[model samples]
Target chain A: MKLSELGEFGLIEIIQSIAEKSQNPRYDSWRRLLVGIGDDTAAWQAGDYIELATTDTLVQGVHFNLNVISWKELGWKALAVNLSDIAAMGGIPVYALLSLALPQDLEVENVTDFCHGLAELANQFEVAIIGGNLASSPDVVITITIIGFSKSNRILKRSTAVPGEQIAVTGFLGLSSAGLKMLQKKTTLDNETTNILRQAHLRPTPRIKEGQLLLQRGVNTAIDISDGLIADLDHICQASKVNAQIKIDRVPVHPLVKVYSLNQGVCRGQLNIIAGLPGSGVIANAD
Target chain B: MKLSELGEFGLIEIIQSIAEKSQNPRYDSWRRLLVGIGDDTAAWQAGDYIELATTDTLVQGVHFNLNVISWKELGWKALAVNLSDIAAMGGIPVYALLSLALPQDLEVENVTDFCHGLAELANQFEVAIIGGNLASSPDVVITITIIGFSKSNRILKRSTAVPGEQIAVTGFLGLSSAGLKMLQKKTTLDNETTNILRQAHLRPTPRIKEGQLLLQRGVNTAIDISDGLIADLDHICQASKVNAQIKIDRVPVHPLVKVYSLNQGVCRGQLNIIAGLPGSGVIANAD
Candidate 1:
């Protein structure tokens, strides 16, 4: 069977199962692994604080087209994806290790520009780009591993929410997808609107501060919306062993998203949000 | 300037300079980063023990060819390189995060085979295969990030050696390089010799136990020989602000390496040793 038939999520599930069934007893005993494959980050105890780690990869053709996005934005998005995983765990990101596979003919200036973008985001989050590896390849590949720490014993997880809770979101949804649609179509719009959409697609922000805030406010279950709102929400439901009833009208969609949908001759309901949860907040049931 | 002109090491130097100059002040104040770049691993303080991290990437054409090496061997080599970094730091490797970029047409069986190889090595070292990311790409790319811990306050650093101290290595050198040559040439040799050379290339062991023993013995400075013996020794010498006088005869080489070199009509001296140091034993100079 080809991996394409199984898709990315299916492949991950198989890998997870293999890892779980074949775990080394000595490793399990020695390393106090608090979390492993299924969570947003793999966590372990390191003294007073719990250490969190997560890794992500971006392929040139699969993840982005250099013709459409600037190298700086590509760099920012690379780190942002890993940071989002750490944010989902409600941890403070401390260090990052980058591994790059670049084409032999890549320009040095483009490489520097990518670093500048990465640096900009790292500066914003106060994450130190500690170390990384570089190699030559047929295409460009970027992998980032982020290490973080959480003082609170209570870590927000995808599997802690109840079925009776009312689902809510932190911010607007579908803007990034709309932005992607605009870019794909090469739709010409007013400068302000185009800038808004382009930035949304090219440089989506990780909700680090918001995640920390949610944890502080006693929200026990959360996840970052990277793989569409519905898909990510489904992950939370599956992990928590509960079903969700999402009111379509209650879903937050940016006004510009509707415009993009209308222009593209598609329904707004079909468009997926790249960030901001389908329903980020939860209201407790009265029982 | 093209990145090819700068090469891997030069590019790393440039990246390191940029990262050092663009460091976040808050990160510096809050997180105590002990070692950042230009070392085998980046290190930080984590309560009683020091935490260590390092990452390495293997591209299909640049690092290995599937025609010459098995998927399982490729998987083993991927983790082995990272383990070598941890060993160089005198740390116990605890967790690993893998990020893979594979072509869309890759077979599911191949991925499973690769996982089996990775799991085998992870089991051997008792390092947990915690989490990873996978994406579709034009070629295969494997990136492994290892996290480790050091109990001792003393860490073996390249810059810590004194001018008078004699350099040393742990095992035989040039075997991996010789193995590569044999594979590249598709040379047919005796079964025993072929197995030895092939194993050396495919599943080179990381000297984790040796590193810990050295640290216990108060050996202050050491490094792994990944980029040839002379090149790596040069790093130690340059970092320590000293000069080295290596006796070529003192270098350890497998008997088959000599045989392979003779068969290829190349001088043994010209064939670089991939592992083992020039002079592993520390001999104090009587000044």
Candidate 2:
């Protein structure tokens, strides 16, 4: 029978039936588990430190368009995005778990390729894919949650940002946004620009190490640039209850973007469109 | 302006605008921030222990059909599924970030309800809605990444089950799947059963406390039951390099599920269809 026929509860029972079979598995130090999978809560001996856990998700049409993005890119981005989160906290990324909702008819090759892309990034990031959950859904949805570790003293939080610290960013901005535009416009470009922008869009390079460096220096408050700088910074500000002023000039934009904007006769405001966060107000300094 | 006009980078810039006007910002004490953003490799701090992270996504057509699920339920589930990941590991959930993609023309109230749902869950779980990205797309997508902390040595991995360990589960299973079936079949149900099944689907509880209990009690290796029992258990077996035997008769199935299945004329595998984890091979006795 179709999944719909089995209904939600039926499907869950099927899932629980199988899930119940997982049993207690893993390392000797953390090995002997009293609670396996049959309870409302679970417990492990954390010892003296706080538990570091992180989760991320990728939607089919939103995060990726199968037609434009390669499985490898999709896989890598999926992992990279999450890794970036751990990095923001001044912590080390250890294990990863993926929850995937895929179209029933997805090809094995597609999945394998996606895995390869995922592995490539995972390996490079030096993190391992411990396990994950897979299910059939109307669309492809990939969600990954990771467990990381850090001392309660060391874990950086947005609430820790103080008033006087200097604001620093690792890489240039606007390239990924530009590349996205290039893709949508289907605009042809010089090999140089095309390669650069496409790479940015398909495989976003998350700032992982920089986060660690900041944390080691004891910069306890941190955040990743998943949302644009303004919005992400807004989070830090809101959490810390502080105010900040950033020069429009200090913010970086790609060279080609300016040229493209000029060529397209787009206003400075339009150029600034790549600067806001979700649910954020209008972009200031459009010029 | 339409999102596309902002170009991907341009849109990000727009979002960044939200973060720009913060009250205070600082970048110091970070000794090893390798690649923060706009770079090839991201390097950050790795203290004495490792870090954990994960991601999950819910889509309009895939995870829920607005016609059946209330906006509140949709929002609740969006965060609930991610929290379930943290509970699966027996970890204490701390912070969460979101990435939502919505089609143009959605009503403001709908968006507010969604946010309300997310905030309520986060508050209830004590998980902070730290930061996330957003975009516009044809389909509505909600992606969330949760960050939590656990002791390094005590962390559980899926590959740790011992040969003789017991397999267990928390709360009832198969209820959501059963609910989905009824919805799809368009079958009528008593208000009581409908409420139970719908609640099962809408606000299925996360096993946070149970997982924590198990973790504290030394349950090291585990994974959540997002997929059916058969599939998730297979992961444990594969990871642990061992086989498990669980009694089908010993398995737990909700009473309401039994009633629904019987009322629906289920037999054999269908007995627990309403809230059953079916097609999962059951071992005679897991002892």
Candidate 3:
């Protein structure tokens, strides 16, 4: 069967099953692997602390077209997505190992620019890009593996949400999706609106501090919205074995996205703005 | 300038320099980063123990051709290369994060076989395949990031060798190189010789146990021969600020490689069989 039929998530599920089934019984005694796959970050007990790890890959013509996004933005977004995974688990990202497969004809300046953009974000998060591998390829591929440490013993998990909790998000969503739409249309948009949408797509800020604060304040259930808000919420619901009733009117939508949707003759309600979590809140339902 | 001019090593040096210069001083106080970049693996203090991390990428057409290698061998070799880095640092590999960028047309059975091969190796080493990201691409790219724990405080380093030390390698090399040549030439050879050479190329055994033994035996200088022996030895010499005079006659050439070289009208003396190091001995010069 074609992978497209299975989709990315399905492929991951199959791989995860294989990994779990093939796990050595001897490893069970290690007492280090606190959590493995099927989570935002793989958590393990390392000495006095727990270490968190996550990996993400961006491919040319698949994740982004270079014609639309510059090398700098590509580099920034590649690391950003991985950092978001760590943030979802309330961990402070520490070290990153980057692997790049570039075409032979790729310009050195472009490669340097990509590194500079990655370094810029790494500096912001205090993550050290310690080591990586480079190889020649037919297309550009960037893979980043981030290692992080949790601040507290309690890590926020999607599976821990209670049924009666009132779900709230920290930032407006659907901006990136709208931004991607705008880029695809290539229509003439106001300078401010274009910048707002492009920046939303190109420079996503992982909710590291917000996630840490949420955990500190006793919030035990949270997940970053990389997928659409409803889809990610479904993850929490499925894992927690509960159903959610999200108030559609309460979803925060970016002003630019609203305008962009209206200009494109689409209803504002149809815009999926609940993606990219800056912070999320859960209140206990007193039934 | 194009990246081809800089080559892989030069590109790495440039990136390493950028990473060092851009390090945030806030992370300097973490006291966990024991070692970073320009080494076999990046070592950091994780709670009470030092942890090691390294990543390697294998790209289609660059690292291997599908016509020459099966998916199983590709998966095995992909993880093996990363484990070699951890082994080089005298560490025990614990976890692996794989990122694969595959063409959309790739068959499901091919992917399943690849995962099985990877899982088989992971089971052998007791290393858990925790999590990974997969994306569609124009070509296949496999990146493996390995996390390991050091056996001792004194991890082997390339920069610690002394002048006049007798350098000895644990395993004979040139087999993989010879195997690649045979594969490329499509030449028929004896079954035993073919199996020996092909196995060397397909399934390289990382010297993890030997590395731990070396550290226990007070050997402090070593490096894996991924590059040619002379090239890798040059890294040790340059890092140690000394020159090495390898006795070519003392090098152990594999019998199959010798026969292959002879058949190809090449001199056996030209073979640098000290490439892959399960354990390399470097004693203090008594001069």
Candidate 4:
């Protein structure tokens, strides 16, 4: 029967029944490791460490519009988003598992290309592709979960922020938002600026190396820029029991961004232009 | 401007501009780490251990059709599918951050309900709701990335399977496939079977505990069942440089599955049904 007729749950049931054979491989042995599949969370004791985990799912037409990105570009951007999280916690990345749900009619060639794109980036970062789930779905949905290690002493957390810490960012801003405008208006961008903004949208380079460096150097209280700068910083402020002072003018807009803002018809400084509402919407009070 | 107008880069540019502060207590030391926002992946070290990370996307119409699911159930399943990947690696679950894209017309109530459903499952699993992203789009899509940890010595990898190790699974089989049949046919399940299959579909219990147990017991090769059994097991076999001798008769079937197969007009034997391949979907030679 068609997927619609089966309904989502019904389809999941079909999938689950087939998977029943895979349970309890190491069951019944005491000290057989402490976690199993039946609880709210899985735990393990490896010498001095116990770690936590989960994954990322960015859906098509939802997280991003196809008309907004190239397949290669999308592949890179999707993975980068999660890497950013690990960076937030002062964790270095070690492993990753990716799950893809694509419509049947999607081009097979594109699938291969997509994997190649993701793999190329993963390889550069030394992130191992540990294998993942591939399924036929109605849309292009790629979900990934990464596992990393911390020395137990250094896993940074949101709750640990202090009230007096300074607020700072690494690179220029407003490029990606500008890229979105270009896509929507179907305007042409020069090679340099196009490359700049494209990198922002298609390939968000999470500050992995820097994050690790910070953690190693004893930096704590951090978050990556998945949400807008002000919003994410607000997270630090709130979690740390402090209110942040934002020098909006201090925001580091890339040269391309500054140019795009001035040359393009789109208003660059407009607060509403930011996706996470850096100074508006839900996070308005944040900055 | 709408997201599409932002193109890929433009959106990111604006995001960078607005996100400015971080709570990193170590910020003074790693003035360099001031930006864990790398070009793609973040490289941070937790204590002495390093982590690797990334995320992917899923969408409706583009990913799954919602008419086939209750909104609340969709919320549960969306996260479940991603967590399944973490399980595949025998990793621990810890925190999650979300980036959701929804059409403006969708009600705040629907959004809240969806979040409640997702959060309930997350909290139940001990996976923290650390942070999230919200945006406007043509479809309703939620993207989440969960962070987890593992020690180098204890991690179980798909590529690490040995040829002679016994391969096994955790739970029953074929019920999900059967449940889909029931839903498509609009067939009602009695209260008992209904409970079984409905849970299978709407809220799949991730095998986190089992994976940790496997890892603790030092079992090296494993994967979660997101794809069909034959398909998923084949991945292990191929990666491990071995062919499996799966006893079609050894796989378990839930009691509800047996009842449904008998009365639901499908060809089946108790053992074969238990092993999945209800209607000759499993080939004798392939076995």
What value does the TM-score of chain B take for model 2? 0.76
Candidate with better TM-score, 1 vs 3: 1
User: Clash pairs of candidate 3?
Assistant: A173-A273, A174-A273, B32-B45
Better of 3 and 4 by lDDT: 3
User: What CAPRI-style quality would you assign to candidate 2?
Assistant: incorrect
Can you tell me the DockQ of model 3?
0.64
Worst 10 residues of 4 chain B by lDDT: B278-287
Compute the lDDT of residue B247 as modeled in candidate 2.
70
lDDT of 4 by residue, B167-210 (tens): 56677776666655665567887887876676676667677777
What are the runs in model 1 whose C-alpha is more than 4 Å off?
A: A24-31, A273-287, B28-31, B274-287
TM-scores, all candidates, are 0.94, 0.59, 0.93, 0.60
Which prediction has more favorable DockQ, 2 or 3? 3
DockQ of 4: 0.06
TM-score of chain B of 4: 0.72
DockQ, per-model, please?
Answer: 0.65, 0.06, 0.64, 0.06
Clashes per candidate, residues 3 or more apart or on different chains: 9, 151, 3, 106
Look at candidate 2 and tell me the lDDT of residue A161. Answer: 62
For candidate 4, report its TM-score: 0.60
Could you give candidate 4's per-residue lDDT for residues A1-287 as a string of tens digits?
A: 43334443343233223222223334211132233221111233434764434355677876778887877777677767766766665555555556566665665556555666665666556665543444445556676665544544455555455555655565666666776677767778778777767666677777766666666766665665555665565555554566666565666666777777778756655522232221210111101
**Whole-model lDDT, candidate 1?**
0.79
